[model samples]
Target: MIKLEQINKYYSLEEETLHVLKDVNFEIKEKEFVAVMGPSGSGKSTLINLIGFIDKKFEGKYLFEEKEITDFSDKELSAIRNKSVGFVFQNFSLIENNTVFENIELPLLYNGSAYTDTKARVQEVLTKVGLADKASKYPKQLSGGQQQRVAIARSIVNSPRFIIADEPTGALDSKTSEDIMQLFQDLNRQEGVTIILVTHNPEMVSYCDRLIRVKDGVIVEEELVK
Candidate 1:
């Protein structure tokens, strides 16, 4: 579902250019679970952003579902990114003031989904992520795990084909992290949702089927974990 060739990313520093990713190349198939693992500053998140179509300023070839992403216009890219990809971040990125139901419903609202259909879809994903009872609660009212679950629910409510998560469990305790990882695993296996997880935790990486290790902005190793 994804293809990258000769991918290169860099950032300009005060004195020199910091090469974040150098000649990166890889492909991820449909329904595949991939773990992007590396130490801090190794460009794991940079690669994730590229794959997610959120960072398109770099130089490379990127294809999604056989179409060249680099060739897309900004509006075209935005359309596909919204309709095809879901994102979860370490910060949980939920609206602090909005109720869980409202937060999850925001995407559909923006996409102009019909009120009835949005209601049904929001409820479905909420239940799937064990947040059905917390629909009316605000993010601050929920614990960290519950908030992350809400984020997960909001991400999948639109039925995105790809889930790109960065440090998904970084803020949670070990047990909660395990639960979150299991949720991602079930989504990958049962729902056939492609998952690209960028994590520093070995336990989280174990949840994925493949691991791609990054260092100095290059993919140094790839391995099958399951």
Candidate 2:
């Protein structure tokens, strides 16, 4: 459902043009669970940013489901992002002040759902993430795993075409990380949710269908998980 051709990205320092991604090319098919891994400063983040539609200043061709993303206006891109992509970061990125239901409802509201109409959809996702009873709680009141579950729920509440999970387990304990990974695996298997996971932990790749390794601004390896 996603394709990148000859992708190249750069950053400008005072006296140097730093190339971040070099001739990167890959395609993620529908319902595929893929993991992107690299050391620090390896450009995986930059690569995912472009894939997630957050960055347009690059030299490459990005086609989403056969449509050229580059052709979209900024406003159009934002709308596409709101509807097509779900993002889960290392930090939960939830509003500490809002109830879990409120946090998940934000996306629906942004998508034009009315306040009174958001409860059912929000409850549906909360139940899917195994947080059905915690919707009334606040982020600060939950464990790290619970908070991350809320974040994942919020991401999928919009029924995005794909989810970009950047270090979703980075902040959790090993057991909690395993639980989160299992949740992702279940979601992909049962719901056919396409996930592009960016993680530093090699162990995490065991749960993904494919592994993509990046190094020094290049995609160094692509292999099936087996």
Candidate 3:
């Protein structure tokens, strides 16, 4: 469903140029759970940003389901991003003041859903993430795992083509992390949600179908996980 060809990205820092992604090439098929592993300076994050339509200034071709992403206008790209990608982060990124239902409803509202009509969809995703009862609670009132579950609910409430999860379990305890990972696995295996995970935790890799390891702005390994 996604393809990158001869992708290269660079940054201009003062007087010197730094390469961020070097001739990266890969494709992620539909419903696949892929993990990207790399050190701090590696270009995994940059690679995902490009895939998720957040970065457009790169030397390469990106094709999503055979359509060229570079062909879209900024507004069109934003629309495509809103409709085609969901993002999860290490820090959850929920609104502190919004109720769980409110947080999950934001994307639908951005897509022009009426505020009055968002409850059913919000409740559906909340149930999918196992937080149906917590819909009226604020982020501060939830445990870390529940908070992250809310974040996951928010991401999938829009039903994007794929999810980009970057260090999703970083803040939780190990047991909580396992629970979150299991939830992710269930999402992938049962619901067929395509997921691209960027994590430093090797234990997390075990849950994925494939692994791609990056180093110094290059992909050094790509293989199916056993």
Candidate 4:
């Protein structure tokens, strides 16, 4: 559902230009479970941000479902992102002071969804992530796994067609990380949510249907395990 061609991202310092991504190219199909693996400074996160529409200052063509979004304005990009994409960060970017329910409800609230509709949607996603019972709890009250579930619920509450997850299990222990990955697997299988995950863990690559390896901002190799 997403494609990038000849993508190049450069950052300008005071006297030097840093190239984060160089001629990157890839395509992710609908309902595909793809993993992006690489070492530090590999531009994996940079590519994620570009695809997620959070950063658009790169040179290249980006097409989502055949529509070129490279030159979309900020407002247009926001609308597209809100309607088409979801994000799960390693840090579980929850509002520390908000309850789980509140955190999940924030997106709908910002989108101006009706209160009744938002309530039902939030509850549904919370239950999907197995966090229904923890809805009233604050972020600090939940364990790492639970917090990540909340983050997942928040990400998927809008029923996004694609999800971009950056090191989704990075902060969790091994068991918890496995659980989280399983949750992602189930989401892909049951809901057909297209997932592009960035991870460094080789073991985690086994869970994905396809793997794309990046080095020095380019796709060096790819494997289809399933």
lDDT of 4 by residue, 1-226 (tens): 8999999999999999999999988899999999999999998988889989999898999998998896688999998899888899999999999999999998887777987888778889999999888888999999999999999999999889899989999999999999999999999999999999999999888889999999988899988968
Over 43-139, each residue of candidate 3 has an lDDT whose tens digit, in order, gives 8888889999999999989999999999999999999999889999999999998988889999999999998999999999899988889988999
Whole-model lDDT for model 4 versus the true structure?
A: 0.92
**Each prediction's TM-score versus the true structure:** 0.97, 0.99, 0.99, 0.97
List the lowest-lDDT window of 10 residues for candidate 2: 118-127
lDDT of 3: 0.94
The TM-score obtained by model 1 is: 0.97
Candidate 2 structure, TM-score to reference? 0.99
Instruction: Give a tens-digit lDDT track for model 1, residues 132-184.
Output: 88888899999999999999998888889899988999999999999999999
Candidate 2's residue-wise lDDT over 152-216, tens digit each?
Answer: 99999999999999999999999999999999999999999999999989999999999999999
Question: In what order do the candidates fall by lDDT, top score first?
Answer: 2, 3, 4, 1
lDDT of each: 0.91, 0.96, 0.94, 0.92
Looking at model 4, residue 225 earns an lDDT score of 65
